[model samples]
Target: MYKRVLLKLSGEFLSGDSGFGISPDTTADLARLVTGALGGTGVELAVVIGGGNLWRGARNGKGMDPATADYIGMLGTVMNAMALQDAMEATGQPTRVMTAIQMHAVAEPYIRRRAMRHLEKGRVVIFGGGNGAPFFTTDTTATLRALEIGADVVLMAKNQVDGVYDSDPRKNPDAVRLDHLSHREVVERRLEVMDATALTLCMDKGLPIVVFDLFQEGNLRRLLTGERVGTLIES
Candidate 1:
């Protein structure tokens, strides 16, 4: 089993059928699934969640200042982090919300050593605020945080996408799912596994990324057990 893993969750997964905003039921269900999967596994889990459900920087920055809009999007991720913390705690899971931006009132500051300590203590660390900078996607945050924490792998949990495909699976039914790919191949082909900067960081650092459908029951557990649940992108 992997000793430590960073889980990257899209905000869309927490929205459920509403397609926007956070859904309590969906968060609760996700909390249960995550807690259940990691229970008794002795794995150190850290999470980096996106803010697409509440705010999309590019799409929402139409008439607003780019930096301001991006900061607002970061705050939205803080909201998501809080919601997730509540859900996970409700399931008796110990979780900590760490933000790159300072918000001592709601969450702790993202200090690398402190984050590593939390994981070592067996607490789930949820990173928010998108690396406290503008013009960077959460994908990059996940990769950076994973590297900082020295995680064995990055688990990219998708909403419904089971793996990487040659084309958009929703638009093209004939799109073939690729179970394995090299980081160089992803960068060369411009696959949607993650943003270019983040994928490049992974490639340069040799950090493995596993993209899989989070909604699939037991997929996380299977992956932790080395059962090849979805796409494996690495060196």
Candidate 2:
């Protein structure tokens, strides 16, 4: 099993089946999954959740300033982080909601050393605010956190998709799921795993990524147990 890992969760996942606002049922389900995975032993997990449900800079802010829209998206992520934190805490698991924008009233400031310390104490750290910068997606934030904290692997929890496919599976019935891929292959093939900048960072750092469906029963547990359950992208 990996000693430590970073899990990238999109805001749509927290919105549940409707793909909108937060859903208590889905949030509770996610909390239980993390609780089960951690069962007092296994990988040290850190989460980076997207704000697409509440805000999408490019998609929703067509007439607004690009940077301003991005900041709004970042704030949305913090809100989602707070809800997830509450649910995780209810599970009896120590979890911290760290924000890049320094929301002292709600979340602690993002300190690299302090985050590592939390992980050492078996606390699940959730990162929000999208690197505290505009024009950067949460994907970049996840990769940045993973690299800074020396994570062994990045577990990308997709909402419905099971793994990386050659093409859009929904549009193309013939799209094939690739079991494994190299970082270079992902880049060359232009896979939709992440943005170019974030993918490049992972390639530079030699960080492996596992893309899998979050709703798959026992999939998270299977991953924690070192059983391959998704498309593994490595160096």
Candidate 3:
């Protein structure tokens, strides 16, 4: 059971089968899933979205400067935040899109107090723009935001992956699924949960993390209600 949770969603979740850009149908479906999960639950929610669907700075920035490419990726996340916000609101879920980079016309600037206030008021806060910095993945943004808002835990929602495995489950049928692990084990073993930076931060700050399948019906609600639906990584 958790009071407040920060959800980390990869951009690929918004892209659907195409795996390139945001799909309206897919986003709407995801929106419904998220809102439905929290419908009767009293848990507060915040989200940090990745930009990998629209842009992967390291993979797409062949000749351009890394920082510039990352900035471009941040913009992509803003686009995603707005789309999710629209879809969620249509489902009667009060949502707010806050950007780390100030774009007054599009989103509210990410202010720690303001975000916390929104959550207290029963609004789902969507954090976009990747912490308003370059070279930091959305993973880091999720961890950072979780810390700033004093969230009970960080929920890493994978597209379809149910949990962390000893090896790549898709490529290796023998890959073992790990249900529980220490943060140190995850970092030392180089598990593909979060980036090393994010893991280390959580380890240092004593933040618990849950990696689970976001598309699974009732998975989010179960996790929030203390039902173990996936991997649990913590100190």
Candidate 4:
């Protein structure tokens, strides 16, 4: 249903049931799912993944330097990018690992035109390093990249969460899942779909967002095909 989609993956998801690091099973499963989706449909795909499993930057306490912590986190993302790329390529899917920070030996520099070109050629592009700057989440990087590439929608792949709720479902029994929401509503209600900056960018660009459970089998493909799989936050 969508021409091109940017899939935002969290580092937490890559960590699988474990609280930290990559799980071979989880990474392989994701690679297969995404590659299968590409085979079935002609949707151009890109990815921006978080580095929470490794380090959360400024969020890390104990007076650590924010920029240095963020840089470490960015490097963690590069590790993730390389791992995902390997998995995809192993499954016969052409993939590119692009990074904001130039690591010539590992990933290509994030060049806007080149990235768009890779997408056009049906290669899955993985964006790493959180915009090559500190104080920005991968969520914001996904937003910016989606705009740059003219994506049809941003597919937010939450770990186990199905959608946006009025409160944390894990904590509140009465928390309500919102099936539909506007950008204004998300900001006004202070929903936890993504960072405020990222949502603001989406609002400015008139981009639609789908926040769904990535761990749920076939949910990603279902969301891409316009099936009801998760919360549709847009307009």
TM-score of each: 0.98, 0.97, 0.98, 0.95
**Once superposed on the true structure, which residue ranges of model 3 sit more than 4 Å away at CA?**
none
Clash list (residue pairs), candidate 3: none
Q: Cα deviation in Å at residue 219, candidate 3?
A: 0.6
| Candidate 4 Cα outliers beyond 4 Å, as residue runs | 59-61
Put down candidate 4 lDDT per residue, 1-235, tens digits, no spaces. 8889999988876677786998878888888887886686888999998888777776663488788888888998999888899989999999999999999999999999999999999899999988999888899999999999899899998766899999999999899999999999999998888899999999988999999998788888787777887899888
lDDT per residue as tens, model 3, 68-176: 9999999999999999999999999999999999999989999999999999999999999999989999999999999999999999998668999999999999999
Give the C-alpha lDDT of model 4. Answer: 0.89
Superposition TM-score, candidate 1 onto the true structure: 0.98
All-Cα superposition RMSD per candidate: 0.9, 1.1, 0.8, 1.3
Clashing pairs in 1: none
User: What's the lDDT of the predicted structure labeled candidate 3?
Assistant: 0.94
Candidates 1 and 4 compared by lDDT, better number: 1
> Which of candidates 3 and 4 is the stronger one according to TM-score?
3
lDDT for every model? 0.94, 0.91, 0.94, 0.89
Q: Candidates sorted by TM-score, descending order? A: 3, 1, 2, 4
Model 2, 66: alpha-carbon shift in Å? 0.8
Overall local distance difference test of candidate 1: 0.94
- Candidate 2 per-residue lDDT, tens place, 83-165, comes to 99999999999999999998899999999999999998899999999898898888899999999999998899986799999
